[model samples]
Target: MALSQTGIRRWYLVHKWTSLICTAFLLLLCVTGLPLIFHHEIEELTGAHSSIEQVAGGGTASLDTMVEDAKRRAPAQVPGFLFWDSEKPLVAVVTASSLTDQQNIVIHYYDARSGAHVPAPPHDEGVMAFLLDLHKSLLMGLPGTLFLGLIGLIFAVAVVSGVVVYAPFMRKLAFGTVRKDRSPRVRSLDTHNMVGIVTLGWVMVVGLTGLILTMATPIALIWQIDELSEISAPYEGKPPPTRLASLDTAVAAARAAAPGGQKLSSVAWPGTMFSSKHHYMIAFSGETPLTERLIHPAFVDAETGRLTEIRDMPWYVKGLFLSVPLHFGDYGGMPLKIIWALLDIAAIVVLWTGLRLWFGRRRVPIEKRVEELRGGGVPEPAE
Candidate 1:
């Protein structure tokens, strides 16, 4: 159904101002996010990542030995977590002066099969990491992240309003129609509408997911205060473990307790924010494409290595985890990444064309613009 004249003008203004407000940041996101869709592949091409060779007989290195190696390298630090690299045959040991230390953190990588230490590239040193930081938080950390989230919300509104305006704009023109013989501004407007319509689904998905991700910090803090508090209540008065059990023992116990088709993703040591003072938090991810991002955490006694309990994350945390792969388009491998990159490029084109239309000199009145939509191919605007 076509919008009434007043309705059309209102929606046109809504689309216009919303697009104008978010266009620049949206462009930045599309540009930075394009490369990030292929981040892993780019890392491989840049040789920034180390690939571990598969060992014969399918034997693997001991987790305990790897932790010892990490400790030897950073004697002053305490191990905070053991993480498995999803895309490679490697493991990472993260250490810091304490669990809550924001600075003075170190990461050590080892071959998952041989336990050979590798000088993995520093996360903050690479171009890809720089791009990622810019894309996620604009290099301003949490404040920047929340700002982008607001931008994303505005972008979503723009997308919806654009769709509403598009229907009336295209009432007389064929779908995907471009009036090349018209003025350059008209041509740009047509192309902008065309591309925006084509990439509507992708824009919404990426925008909403990014908005959700920006709330990660607050969500985590809430989890720590709410669910985490209740889960650790049984051991509330317990002291930090004086003698930690073997890493292998904790991992084995967690794995044995995990349901079928799940593998260990990470282990937060006892006394860390993610775990109780007397228990290790072992997180597991499923093998399937969709389930891989949704993780479950199990608590295990630090000294005895016995499984205490396993629980699925709350809905909000699961939403956070699910958005990661969907936002990056990494879960489906190369094919999906290519699709995401193409859509990102198209989004960039749409934003550019929209900006060109908005910045055109000879401003057409809202009434004239609406008349143009109704009449289809109104004579070119006076130069």
Candidate 2:
């Protein structure tokens, strides 16, 4: 199949502009995201959280007891949520925010059995944290994330246009072939094309999924309007309770009222974004591969310790949740992680070669360039 002259020119324009706009950020994304693939490994090797040790005897403590213990450790903070760690059975993490400032939240670790404060790993305070922040938000927070998302959008366009160009480029040659004996310009072009083809599937998946990740905040906000507003509507005007029921009791009631096969695993206390100011938001994540991606929010009266409403999660919210593990290659075991690393390296090469080919292109008549583009490429002597 042959691409028309007009189509070739149009797609070239699209590829050129989009690639120019997103190449730099995409390079940064590749470089920083590389370490993130091995983030946990690096953290463990550096002993970032080594100071936090499992309590002897490996016993579990009551969530109610740990909440008070965490408050004693951070007296000025208000407990917001409690999460269980799968890797460390004897550890529970308590996220508490400032009494005066909502934005200031401190994370505290407690021995799950004894309810004693456990020092957080140094990694939480050091380089890994910095790397994660830099990769995700560029240290500029929401604006940075949104900006990266926009760049990702451009990257997607560039990928599509490049694909359009590739079909025409490969029409005259074997797929993935590189002309090593040709001039530097020819070789560079070939390298770019070959690497791009090899990694096309990966960059597409990573790029598209990466783009979805950048919209995480906006997606959550959408859920808030569609799910949160509707579920918490009845209690909209009610004041937050000063005395809430015990978390253990709340959990028990949530479980008792939950539908068959749905178990409440996490809870968001009153006065937090995950819950209404007047109710506890208990979350039930499914055990199945897909269902586990989204949380079904269960609302319970903070003062009464009784479940009021439990609604299924919206698809968009589930999509957001599912994207996380896939984007990071977290679902499968070590084999999949290795495959992710390999593809990541290939993507970096494609980015670099593409950048070089674009910038180093010879300055010639637009018609001549378009003609060269119309075919797979021009001869080395043509330039």
Candidate 2 achieves a global lDDT of 0.75
Model 1 pairs whose backbones collide: none
Candidate 2 pairs with clashing backbones: 48-122, 48-123, 49-121
Residue 141, model 2, lDDT:
82
- Tens digits of per-residue lDDT, candidate 1, 1-383, equal 86788888788889889989998888888898888888888777664254565443332689889999899999999999888877666788999999877446788988887788877676667889889889989998879999998998898889898888888778778888888887888889889888889888877888888999999988888888887787778876777779999888888888898999787799898877788778889999987877888889998989888998899999999999888887989888788899889888998999999888877734776567767665654546765
Please report how far candidate 1 places residue 267 from its true position, in Å.
1.2
Error of 1 at 226 (Å): 3.3
- lDDT by residue for model 2 over 1-383, one digit each (tens)? 57799989999889988999988887887788877887767766665245556544444467788787778777877888766543454444345454223345666666666667766563346777788878888888889999999998888999989888888777778877888887776787788888887878877888888889999889877876777777668876777688989887887778787777764456777767677777788887776765666678788888999888888777887777888877888567678878888888888888888777777666555676577677667544354
Error of 2 at 218 (Å): 1.4
Task: Give the TM-scores of the predictions, in the order they appear.
Answer: 0.92, 0.90
By TM-score, the best candidate is 1
